[model samples]
Target: MTSLAEATGHALDLLLAGDAGLWQIIAISFKVSGSAILLATPPALLTAFVLAYLRFPGRRLLISLFSTLLSVPAVVVGLTLYLLLSNQGPLGDWRLLFTQSAMVMGQVVLAFPILVAMGHAALQSVDKRAWETARTLGASLLRAFFMVLREARFGLLAALLAAYGRIIAEVGASMMLGGNILDYTRNIPTAIALETSKGEFAQGIALGAILLLLAFTLNGILQHVQGKGVPST
Candidate 1:
């Protein structure tokens, strides 16, 4: 108990003192995860819309694939991405491996299925009459689509928030593709892993605390957005 208390005190000191490395890791984490979510949102939204409204061949298969992917292990994603970005792989010439972009790419892939699935649910929950009413009022197909989207805005926002939560908390893909390089690709999860392994429990605890705070802040924002009826950007 004494050792635990001492460790807690040390962790608090590190956090209060504003360690530079910790801040760098936090920044990198936000940058990679934020960028991944942003880049993924458009396609996810479009795919969800199609899945919810359009009836075509293989739609069920596509939905099934995404559902399966939602349960996919993070390590599998990391290994798959690593192989694709390795020297002998198709994308090897790009030299993207071990970079922030690589980490973002992996996260984007990881988050895509969740975004698509949830977004589809949100869109499907909208009233069909809403779309018909807009169409009857002479709204173009695009305008009617937007109207349906507006009604489902809250659910869509939920999807975005969920995707953000997943990407930010994930460690495997980021570590594998980014190489967890200090001051570069290192993020909260990767930093926590590396620090704990090295017996730097104080820094690890501090990062873990920050990560928990981030999760809380995100959930708060999600609730606010849902209450405000704001359209996800």
Candidate 2:
């Protein structure tokens, strides 16, 4: 108990003292995950828009496919990318393996499906009349697109937060693709794994605390957004 207490105190000190190594890990985490989510969002949301509004053939299959992807393990994604980016693989010429770019790619894959599936759900919540009325008013398709998006903004924000939450903390994809190189591709989850494996419980505790605080803050914002513009009972 005394040792645990000591480790906890040290963890708090590291977090409070602005530890450079720790902050660097945190920065890498945000950089990779942020890039992944941003790059993935527009495409994912566009695809979701299509799936939600279009009635083309095989649409149901596509929706089901994305929904299924939501359940795929992160390790599977990491392995697949690892194979593709490895020497002798199709994309080996790019030589992206064991790099932050590869980590971003892995995370983009991990976040894409969640954004698509959840974005589709969010778009589905909008009243079809909103689209019809906008068109009826002679609003250009682009304008109507923004209008529908406006209606679904809160839910879309929720999806964004959820996707960010997932990729930010995912260890497998980052670990396999990044090799967890310190001061390079190292990130929060991978760093925590390293610290814990080495029995350096303090840093791991600090990083874990960050993840918990992040999750709580995100949930709080989501709840607030969801409640906005709604009549209070």
Candidate 3:
């Protein structure tokens, strides 16, 4: 217990002293996950919208496939991407392995299915009349689509938060794809893993503190969004 308390104190000191390496790790985490989520969101949302609203052959199969992907292990994604980006791989000429971009790619694979599945559920729960009402008002198909999205905004936001949470917390994909290189591709999760392994508990605890704070902030925003979404009594 004394050792734990001392470690916690050291963690606080690290944060208070503004450790540059720690902050750099945090920044890399956000940069990679942010880029992955941003790049994946539009297409994921579009696919969700289609699955929720459109009728087509094998659509159910596609939805099932995406839903299955939601549970895939992070290391599996990293391995598959690693293979594709390795020197002998077909697309290896781009030389993206063991880089931040590779980490982003792995995260994109992880987040895309999550966004699609959650976004589909959200869009499906929304009233069908939203699209119809917009069309009744002579809104273009694009405008009607926007109307549906507006109605599903809260749920979509929830999906976004969930995706961010997953990617930010994931370690295997980032570690394998980014190689956990110092001052470059190192991120919070991988850094925590490395630091803890080296008996450097303070930095790991500090990074964990930041992650906890971020989780709290996201939950707060989710609650606020939910409150605003609810109809007044």
Q: After superposition, how far is residue 144 of candidate 1 from its true place, in Å?
A: 2.9
Give me candidate 1's TM-score against the actual structure.
Answer: 0.92
Per residue, candidate 3 scores C-alpha lDDT tens digits across 75-144 of: 9999899989999888799999989999999999999999999999999998888888899999999889
CA deviation > 4 Å runs, candidate 3: 231-233
Residue lDDT tens for model 1, 105-185: 999998999999999999988877887899999999989988988899889888888899888889899889999999999
> Can you give the TM-score per candidate against the true fold?
0.92, 0.96, 0.96
Scored by lDDT, model 2 comes in at 0.94
Candidate 1, residue 227: the lDDT equals: 80
RMSD of each: 3.0, 1.9, 1.8
Q: For candidate 2, which ten residues in a row score worst on lDDT?
A: 224-233
Error of 1 at 194 (Å): 0.1
After superposition, candidate 2 runs with Cα above 4 Å error: 231-233
Clashes (N, CA, C under 3 Å) per candidate: 0, 0, 0
